[model samples]
Target: MKKRIVSLAMAACLVLSMMVTLSACGGKPTLEEYYNSDAMQTIITAAVSQYEAQGVECSVTASGDELRYDFTIDIQTTEEERAIYAETLESQMPADYQEFIDEAKSIKESVSNETVTVVVTYYDADANVLYTQSYSSDG
Candidate 1:
């Protein structure tokens, strides 16, 4: 009887340990939820609204691991804007584009001269990545 009791106790301990190890805890963070999340979504919407006030058209899109925030703006775009922007962005420009460009290329690459930060989330479940969502938050 003593031996039998000892064996049963060991078995219970093993079973309990196994169950604990098999259980999954919490959840993986995902981008879909981040963009869809009301809190984060609201922040992005407000920022976009402010940008729209400047006559810029923009929207946020996320798919898989890719995240994009597209924006287009209309400006009087005098030589002053380009000159000022060029001077401001001069230090940051890559060696390739450091030289002068034709008017067409200058206008095309102008927006690329600016930078913005966006925060996104990715979620995983059952050892598989579920979805990704992205949104930009105001600093």
Candidate 2:
């Protein structure tokens, strides 16, 4: 009877472990959820510091399936720098979350040379604009 109980307990443990593993493999979080995540913010902050050259102020806002990253650089960044920044942002997206970026309804990025305002807007899958915000530079 003792041996039988031990075997049964081991089987239960195995089943519980499998259940936990399966739940962990569930689908990734939505873009809106990830927008507020520390991981995303850290990645964006690092990328901005890398590309801004001088200095930048950044703000992030998110609602539902929408996310906005707004930043300002001290100087009027060159087009090359903007391209690099965008690419770096793309690369920083976690692999599992890349699908959210790919399937987004729209992505709009505007950088102004006159005032050094940067605005990035991302729309949800339903064609609704998630959010729009602005960034400023010191210069």
Candidate 3:
């Protein structure tokens, strides 16, 4: 009777271990799933609100693993001004740019192992492209 009880207990333990292992192997989310998740939407909404509060119209979208940010400035500017803006961006990214990138990478890593690409485009009031920047997690 004692041997039978021990064998049954071992069998139960084995079954439980197998169940745990199988559940853990459920697989990571696809890029589309990550983008369409409520968490991603919340992040996008917050970003839009932050930029809008600063008088810039901002919209964010995701296609595959690429996240795009479109910002429209309220005022029109000359070609010289656009050139200067682009030069400044090339020299130094925005104060919060690295922070934003880190956050995005963290979120992406949590959901999938795929690379995440971020594209930011700035536009004037007339929808003229001012400056554009791209970043990739693979870097």
Best by TM-score: 3
lDDT (tens digit, per residue) of candidate 1 on 46-72: 656766777755576644433455554
- Give me the runs in candidate 3 sitting further than 4 Å from their true place: 1-25, 94-97
Cα deviation of 36, candidate 2, in Å? 2.9
Clashes of 2: 1
Candidate 3 per-residue lDDT over residues 58-126, each given as its tens digit? 988778777788989997888888888778766776775785587557546645647887788888898
Decoy 2 TM-score against native: 0.33
lDDT of 1 at 57: 57
Could you estimate the TM-score for every candidate?
Answer: 0.37, 0.33, 0.69
How many clashes in each candidate? 10, 1, 0
What's the distance in Å from true for residue 128, model 3?
A: 1.7
What is the overall TM-score of model 3 with all chains considered together?
A: 0.69
lDDT of 2 by residue, 5-118 (tens): 764465445534543543486734444444444544554555455445545455556554345565544444445655665566556544525333432321211111222223
In model 2, pairs of residues that clash are: 72-136
> lDDT per model, in order?
0.40, 0.44, 0.70
